[model samples]
Structure formats: C-alpha cells, structure tokens
Target: MAPTNLELVTLGHRIRHERVARGWTLDELGAQVGVAGSQLSLIENGKREPKLSLVQAIAHATGLEVTDLLAAEPPNRRAALEIELERAQASPVFRSLGIPPVKVTKGMPDETIESILGLHRELDRREREAIATPEEARRANTELRLRMRERDNYLPEIEKLAEKQLAAAGHVSGALTHRTVSIMAERLGFELLYVNDLPRSARSVTDLENGRIYLPPASIPGGHGLRSMALQAMAHRLLGHQRPTSYADFLQQRLEINYFAACCLIPETNGVAFLQQAKKDRNLAVEDFRDAFGVTHEAAAMRMTNLMTQHLGIRLHFLRVDGSGAISRVYENDDLPLPMDVTGAVDGQIACRKWSARAAFSEQNRTTEHYQYTDTPAGTFWCATQTGTTADGEFSISVGVPFDDARWFRGRETTKRAVSSCPDEACCRRAPSELTSRWEGKAWPSARVHMQMFTPLPRGNFPGVDDSEVYAFLERHA
Candidate 1:
C-alpha cells in the first residue's frame, strides 16, 4: 500500500534532520542534487511529493543510500503525538481552554518520546476498537440469539441452581418480597441499602469492600421493578462469573444472570405447574400470569415465552418495541422470517406499520392489551401486545406464535385480522396512490423527526457508571 499522509510527513522531518546534522544549506544541497533550492525546500517541508530520481539525487548528496532514505520506518515513535499537538495548538479550542500545547525539540530521543506516548496510543486503540457501528452491534446480538436458539433459549442448569438457592433459604414458592431479598443478601454477607440519594443514571451499586449494596429509589420505583433489580444484584453475588472479555460474552452472562433472577421471582416448579394447568385449560395469558406472580406484564410475557418454549414444547416469538416503532428486543423459536437488516433485529429499525406490534402503539388506551391475527411471508401468526408508559415515553411488548400454536393462548378467539407482506418494497410500507393524491396538496402533516439514533451505551457491573462515563473516567486516569 502507498504511504499515508502522516508517513510522508515523518519522512520529510527525517530528511530535514539529516540535512541539518550535515550542516548543508538548502542552496548547497540543491547544487549537489541538481534540483532548484525552492523545490528542495518544498520536499523537506512535506509540501511537495518528490519523484524517485529527485529522491535518489538528494540521497547521494546527503551521503545516504537511496533505499535508506526511502525506508518504511517512521522518523520517531511520537510522530502521531507531534502531529496532533501541532493541529491542536493551531485550533481555537486550545486557546479557549487556556492550555497551550507543549513544545519539544525534534531531536528528543525516540525511546523517551515512545514511553510518554505509549499510553496515549493504547487508549486511542481501545477507543477505536470499541466504537461499534450499528451493523457490528447487531451482529453481536444476533450471535447471542443464535446461541439461545441452539439450546431453545432454555438454561435448565441455571434454573436448577436458582431452585437450590431458594430451597436452602427455606423460601418456598410465593411472591418475592423485600424480606426475601434481604435474606438472600444477608446470606451472601452483603448489606442492602435503599435510599433516594443515588444518581438518576444509577439503578444499583455494590461495594464489595464495605459490604454494602446501594439501590436508588428514584430509578427502581417500586413493585416488580424493585424486586428484579434486587434479585439481579443477588445473582451477581451468588453466581461466580469471570470478568467478561468481550461484548458478546458480557451480553451472554447478563442474559444468564437475568434468567437466574427471573427464576427467583417466579419459582420454576410452581411456574411450570401453573403453565401446565393454563395450557390444559387453553387460557394461557400473560396478564393473568402477571397478576398471579406479582410481576410486570413484560416480565410475565418474557417468562411465559421461556417456559413455553423450554418446558411446554411450544415454539414462540417475543418482541419489545419503543414508541417510535423500533424493535428493541426479539426472540423467536419458530419459522417466522423476522424483519432484519444485514445484522439482525435490533433497536432503530422501524417495524412494518401493518404488523400488530407496531399497531399496538396507536391504541387509545395504552394500558389495555391488544391482539391481532396476521399473515406474513413466513406464515400466519397470532400476537398479543400491550403498551406501557416509561420515562422516555411508551414501549410495547408482544408475544406471538404460529397460527397452529395459537390454540393454547387466551386471545385465540380474536377475529381482528391483517395481512403483512412485510420487508417487501411493494407491500404495506408504500402509501396508496389515490389517498396520497387526495392529501398531497390539501394537508401537510409534519413528518416525524428523530432527535438521535440508538447507540449501545456502555454499562458497568456497577449501576453508578453508564456507557460514555466509563470512557470519560478512563481518559482522566490515562
């Protein structure tokens, strides 16, 4: 590959240093190399690219071999630092900050310069490696989903482990309470504190040295949300997980931790028994499960999918969507061809407007559940969806199954129907020509505008540190 601009600049610096060491004036060097002094000056300043002949002529005059003059080596290890310093010193921001850039002679030993710049280079490399584009983020999530599908999204080992913990604490099947949470934490020698002083960005923080676990009253509100956060922290203490090495492993470990918490919230044996009875009665509903277990609707729906697919021998799909029609989470153990980009189903991609999940957002009553029968390119599916209010706005959770498998769900009797030729350009995404013509000049509704796109925020094991905040801390210490 051709040399980069920075490499060329370094070469120029090296050439200038060589001439200075030899005490050769620009005119004197130009006379020996048969090139004009102005041209030679330009070459030394990296203002002009020299031909091979010109370079060879200069090499001979400087008492260096042609190959040595054009060697691939950079002039110094701190080349990048110097370049950046020069650019920053010339910028308005540097003066605004009242911090002038440091100036060092080019004659500084390369070894000493390298030692100073090594940490900066390492931090730069880490930041570059960590900035994932949307496609890369989706690919990582897709790999985890495939792994879940490989095992049918069921981790019996985790469930069994959770059950043992429950049995050892003498905590029989019942709604999880604060006392239950305290018992588990005390057994692990962790002090639990609930207070309103924690920051909004934090949900919880564990201080291993002080033996305290802090939960923010503002973030975790109450009820199931509080229980889930407490149990999640408990799982972290009980489960011995190695420090995550990559983002993928981090996500997988988190999913495992979440599953352990869910098992605690709703005991496996009792949950399975309830599901079996519901399946027999042909009235399985997520809302009823939520009422029975004292969990949120989304929690109940997700747990039902896990239990049904893992224990009941039923295949299903689950989706969580935001108010803007973007799918936040999706899991499928069926033949449905979910809408996807090059990576997979992830946040930011708009769901087809005709689908039940997207249509759930338009309902007048956000608290009420909606059900629909829809035919897609993959097959027919019956879906139940409900919208819940959130700090950011509203989000919908949906549980769907193949038409043949719908008999076991409560909304099987619904007659509302729609056809989705989703992911196709000629399908529902296109506006009807007649209606468009009618409103083209008569009405001018403003188009929806997104303030920002979804980017995966870095989350620490401690709730106190959010995504970019960790990077900022690293910068300060580095």
Candidate 2:
C-alpha cells in the first residue's frame, strides 16, 4: 500500500525538526544519510517519501531510534503548524478554491499560516453544516443503534405484544395476511382508510380522535410496505405512545413501532419454526424468508437481525445501500467495522465499494440474490445481497454473517469472493497514486453533491411529518 499524504507530511516535518534541533543544514544531513542536499530538501518539504534504509540512516545520524522519528505527533508547535498547513493545502476544498497554497518557509510568520488555516477551518465548517439536520437526531440514532446491538436486536415485550395481537386476529400459521392486519386495526378501535393525498412526508397517519389510520392508495393485495406501515401506525396506539418529548423519544418510538410491525409481519412463533427447519436442512436464505412472509428482501434481512442471534445462535449484519453506494441503513452484531462519521452515525457515510452490497449491483442477473465471501480487515464475512428498485432509486439489501456461521445458511459455497482493506485511503475512496500524480492539477470536475447531504429531517410531531399537510389532506378527504 502507498503511504498516505498526511503520513508523508508528518514524516517530513519530524525529520526536518530533528535536523534543525541538531543544528545541521540539509547538505550536512545528506552527507550522513548518503542522500543529495536537494533530495533532503524535498523530504523536509513533504514532497518526497524517503526509503526505509535512508530513514534508518537519518535516525542513526540524529542519535534516535527509527520509531522516535516516525511518531505520529510532531516535535513542536512549529512542526504541528507545518503539518496542519500541509494537510489543509492538500484538501479537496482548498484545491477547489483555485488558490495556490502558501509555502511555509522559515522567513514566513506563524500568524500568516494561522490565518490561512482559520479560513480553511471556517470553509470546512460551513460545508459540513450545510445540512440543517440536528446533532441531537444523529446522537439519537447512534444511541439507538448501540442499544439494539447490545440486545442482539431482540425486543421481547414488542414480540410478545405482536404475538398476542396476531393470536387475537386468528393468525396461526403462514404469512400475516392483509385481512389479519385490517382485523388488528379494527380490534384497536381504528379503521383503515386509503387516501390519494396522505401528506408528502408521512408514510401513514394515525388520527387518535377519529380512530382512523390513513394510508396511501398505491398498495396492492398482500403488499410489502403498505401492511408494515399500517401495523406500525397501529403499534403507536396499542403501545400507548404519547407525543415524543425529544428527538431521542421520537427515535425510540419510531424504532419500537417498526419492531412491533416486524414482529407482526413475521410472528416469532412461525418465523422461528421456519428458520429452525431451514437451519436443520442447511438451507437458510433471506429470499426464502421474504417469500414465506410476503415481505421485501430488505425487510426480511432486517428482521433476521432481531431473531438470528437470540434464537438461532447466529450473529449477523444487515445493510441497505443505494446505487451510489451510500448506506441508508445498517445493523451489525458481528463487528463488521462499518464506516461512521465523528458523531458515530452511519447515515452520512458510504459503504466500501468492495462490499458485497456494492458488488451485487454489478451482477448481470438482478432477478436472484447475489452471494460473496468478503475478506475485510475485521474478518471473513459471507454475505447475500438482493437488488431492487423503488421510487427513490435502485438499492441492494444484504444480510451477512461471520465465516463460522456460514454452515447454517445457503450460498456458503459461492465461488465469488473478495478482499477489502477498507478504512484505508487506498482501499477504494482515494484514487491510485499513479492516477493522482498524472491528473492532480489537470482535472477540474464539478462534484455532484448527494441529495441526502442537504435533506434534513422533516419537522412535526414525528420526524419527516408535516402537520398542516396532514390536516389539510384529512380536511379535504373527510
């Protein structure tokens, strides 16, 4: 692997600081390290990476160990400033400004460099804060993800409630039918109404006063999302959820409702029995689960996370990735080391291009599930991904497990395999060093900022809900 630009810069700064402290010129250091004065100058300016042997020789001449010379922290404040400036100058934002970077010579004042860094810092802050999403929402997401991970994704209370409701609705075996869902709604003292305009943001609206559940009119018989949405809306009432007090409360309520819906869609009693049979036959598959329950692949994969570890002694990860490789959802109990932002939120992050979720998109056959065993830095993971489309765009839903758990699942013998050294710059995010060197300054491409980057959570009683629009929608239809 090639050295990252920041590493090279730090090494250069350390070497220069050590040489300067020893009261030696570039020529004097070059004589001891068997390198030319111009080459030493290049090394000090963070433009060139020195060979290991030459670095060792420099350490020997400086009366220090190679490790000391290669420490991540710089020697002094001056060296730190130089390193920061060098890194800042190399950033895409700085490059996009079309301003030539200022050289940090000994004659240049530190105040000037600080001023430039301040400007860079402000520009970076503005770019990051472009989206008006609240930090509390992201923190809530991180907290919920961690909480779910801790429990192995199972909620016994919600599961029990769903089972009880299903039993009351006379749903014993097979998939929970549309009739059962309607029955559950009726039992909850609510009626389901199909409407043309159910608010652009709201998936389904529950009117507590009117005892009604309003849903969109695009659903078919025994559909995937429509039933789930209805059950989720009913969950709020059955669970006696009040208005969310904070973002955390809102997120928690949303998760609970979704969990309740999942349990109702794939009842624990039937879903586990089916999974146990499949495990006995060594034929566990997400598609089979989805087919059995009449749910979407993404739904089946996510539902697995809730049941697999607690019931089947299997730990797994789930991912939903869009066509552009952005991760829209994730859940991992197998230490998948997913990419995350500083807030520990995965929403703003992109899945590794080499991941099975991304690789499955390139498969010529989109009709069936794609399987692969990926060798990531965490460990070997066996994954199966199914690609599908929606009004938004194309997406891939994936369920993966650790190598040892592959025995109980289908596609364990897939010849398709990959090795990914992700969280590394050279893995997939950065261009090849050769290509960067060839096209660094010659190319000027306008970046197409992602739509998700600027779209903040909608404001209302629930996130992504519009109160006035829902009221107006109801006023016209009622």
Candidate 3:
C-alpha cells in the first residue's frame, strides 16, 4: 500500500535533513540521484512520494540506509512542528472551524508557528473531549450490535459460565430463584445487601474490597426480575472488567455483563430444553417463556433471540421501542428493515409508526400481547409486542420473524396486518397531501426536543457514577 500523507511528510523531513547536514543543495543531491532538481525539491517538500528505486538511490548518495530515510519521526524539532501543523490543518476539526490555514514558509518565524499550534492544540483538545458523548457512543453501539447480529447474538462461553455458576449453586431445570441468586453470589465470594440509601445514579454497586454488592430496597418500583441487577454486578467481577478507557470499552463491558446476567437468569441448557419442547408442541409464545422463567417480558423476549437462532434454527429480530416511536433497543439478523441513522444506529431513531412496536402502544387491550403481520418492502413479518410502563414511561418490547418462520410462534393467526414502505418518507413520516395543502404554511407546531440527546455522558472512572457518593454510601453502611 502507498504511504499516507503523514508518512510522506515525515519521510520528506528526513531526506531534507540528510542533504542539509551534508551541506548539499537540492541540485547537487539531484545530480547524484540522476533526478531533476525541481522534482527532488518537490519530494523534500512532502509534495511527492519518491519511487523505491529513487529512495534507494538518494539513500546511497546521502551515505545513509533507506530505513533512515523512512524513519517515523521528523528529523528535527522544526520539522516535527511543521508536520504537526500540516496534520492539524488537514483534519476535519480544523476545517470545520472555517479558519484559513496559515501557509508555512521558510521565512515564517518559529514563534508564530508555536502560537498558531497552541491555538490548534486547544481547539483539538476540546473536539476530542466532546466526541466521547453521543456520536462516538452511536458509532460504538452500532458496531457492537452488528457484531452481535453476525454471531446470531449467542455467546457459548457465557452460556457455559452461567451453567457452571448455577450448578455450583445447586440449581437445575427451573426458574432461577432469588435464593439461588444469593447462593451464586456466595459461591463467587460476595454477599448481597439491600439498602434504601443507595445512590440514585447507580442501579447497583459492588464493594470489591469488602466482597459485598449493594442493591436498592426490595419495595422499589418495577421490581419483578430485579435479580438480574445483582447478577449483572457479579458479572463484572466474573468477567474481570476494568474501568473503561473509551466509549467502545464502556459499551462492550455493558454488553458482556448484560449477556452474562441473561445467561444466568435463563440458563442455556434448561432454557433451550424448554424452548425446544414449546417448538415441538407448536406453541411458542413470549409470555409462556416469561412465565416459565419468571422474568420480565423484555428479558424473555431477548433470551428467545439468543436461543432461537442458535438452537431452534429460526432467525428473528427484537425491538424495545418507546411510546414516541423512538427505538431504544433493537436486534435483527433476519433483514427486518429497521430504521437507522447515518451511523447505522437504530437507537433514538423513530420506528415506522406502521410497525407493531409503535402500533402496540395504541392497543386497547395492552394486558395481552399485541400481534401483527407487517408487510414491509423486505418481507412480511409476524411480531408479538408487549407494552409496559416504567419510570422512563411507556415502552413496547417486540420479537418478530419472517412470514415463513411465523408458524413456529403462537401469534401466527392474528388478522391484524400493516404494510410499511419505510424508510420511504411517504410511508409514515410525510403528511397527507390534502393536509399539507390545507395547513402547510398556517401550522406552526412547537417541537419538543429531547434533552437527553443533547446531554453529555457522565465523566469519571465509571460512566454516570459519582465516585464520592458511592464511597460515602459504602462508608455509612460499613
């Protein structure tokens, strides 16, 4: 592959340094290398990448090896400063500022260059600091989701680990009890403690030094399947995760811990056994799975995705969409045609209002699961969505499969159906032509901006965690 622009610049610095050290002019070096003086000057100025033969010839003429000419660092401090300036100017951050770049010439004072570099450094540092929030988060989340989809969202190692932990706790072939969860924690050398004074920002906290996991009181709201929180805390220790150094690390660690907790809550061997039996009976339903495991509808739905493709040979997708039609969590390897932003991230992107995830929110009988067959451009899919309320407000959790694979699920007979031409704006996003003609210029609706989108992710060792508050709470409890 050809060297990058930066590489060419550094290489040029080295070549120029060698000739100057030998007190030779560009024409003199050109004479020895059998190249035109102007061409050689261009190579020295980082405007040209020399051929390997010419590089070798120049190296031989300069009494140095080709390796010396291709060294990574610029040959002098002046060259280093110049190279840094050139790179910073070429960056998108610098270009976005709309400042014209200064032309670095031989007569430009080093002091002036240093002043300009200092300003660039400050602007560059600010850019790096702000990038770790949403944009980087979206990119990381998008990449991680694609990876999980590629692997059928199954991790055999985590499944085995869960089985081992369960066996050690003497749990076999049933819904994992709270007692079993505490026993598993004991086996891992940790004790579970419930407290009302736990920090609000933290769902659960692990005191690694004291071998204790602190959780909120049992009476807290949305309490069913709360065992997963403690299990997730234990998972960090089991997985040997450290403080995340980047947004990607934060996202990966979160995914792993959640995967571990899901595996523990729904042991692979027994869970798959239950699912296989259901499939044999031709009666697969998310509610049945949730009742059997005593988990929330969301957990049960997500677990089916993990096992269905890997064990039952059925490909599917899962979505957790909010009442406003924004997708909060999603997974699909079956080409369900989810809405996505430029980064391929579905989270925070609005799901088509025609899809079951959004349609379920409007259902009158939300106590029962909502089922529908959506005829999308990709293919028809059968989906089961269960809407629920939490502190964050209403959300619909859905699991879907292709029209052909819908027979394996219980909601196959529902007459409810919708046709979606999304992501075509005309499908749902655009207003009707008659409405537009009547009120296009007259209507001025107030848009509600979601502040969470503009908020920066919490900074410090652990994301969104206040270290001092956690320590104080642990101290008072200790």
Give the whole-model CA lDDT for all candidates, comma-separated: 0.74, 0.87, 0.89
lDDT, model 2, position 280: 96
Best by TM-score: 3
Clash numbers, per candidate: 1, 0, 0
Task: For model 1, state the Cα shift of residue 14 in Å.
Answer: 36
lDDT of 1 by residue, 1-478 (tens): 7665555666676777678779988888888888888888887766688888988887877788977777756455465556544444445534565765555576877665555456445644454345444455567788888888778778888899888877777788767777887788888888778765554465665667667777756443446776677778778767777766456666767798889889888888989999999999998888888888788888888887678877898888888888888888888888666777766645567777777888887788766679999888998999999888778987889998999989998989998888888788656666789887877778878987665545354533431256464344324433
Q: What is the C-alpha RMSD, rounded to one decimal, of candidate 2?
A: 20.4
lDDT of 3 at 377: 94
Candidate 1: pairs in clash: 458-467
lDDT of 2 by residue, 96-197 (tens): 989999877788888988998899898876554332257877888899999999999999999999999999999998777878899999998999888887
Lowest lDDT sum, 10 consecutive residues, model 3, at 217-226
What is the full ranking by lDDT, best candidate first?
3, 2, 1
The order by descending TM-score is: 3, 2, 1
Q: Which tens-of-lDDT digit does each residue in 369-425 have in candidate 3?
A: 999999999989999999999888999999999999888888789999999999999
Q: After TM-score superposition, what is the CA distance of residue 354 in candidate 2 from its true location, in Å?
A: 1.3
Which of candidates 1 and 2 is the stronger one according to lDDT? 2
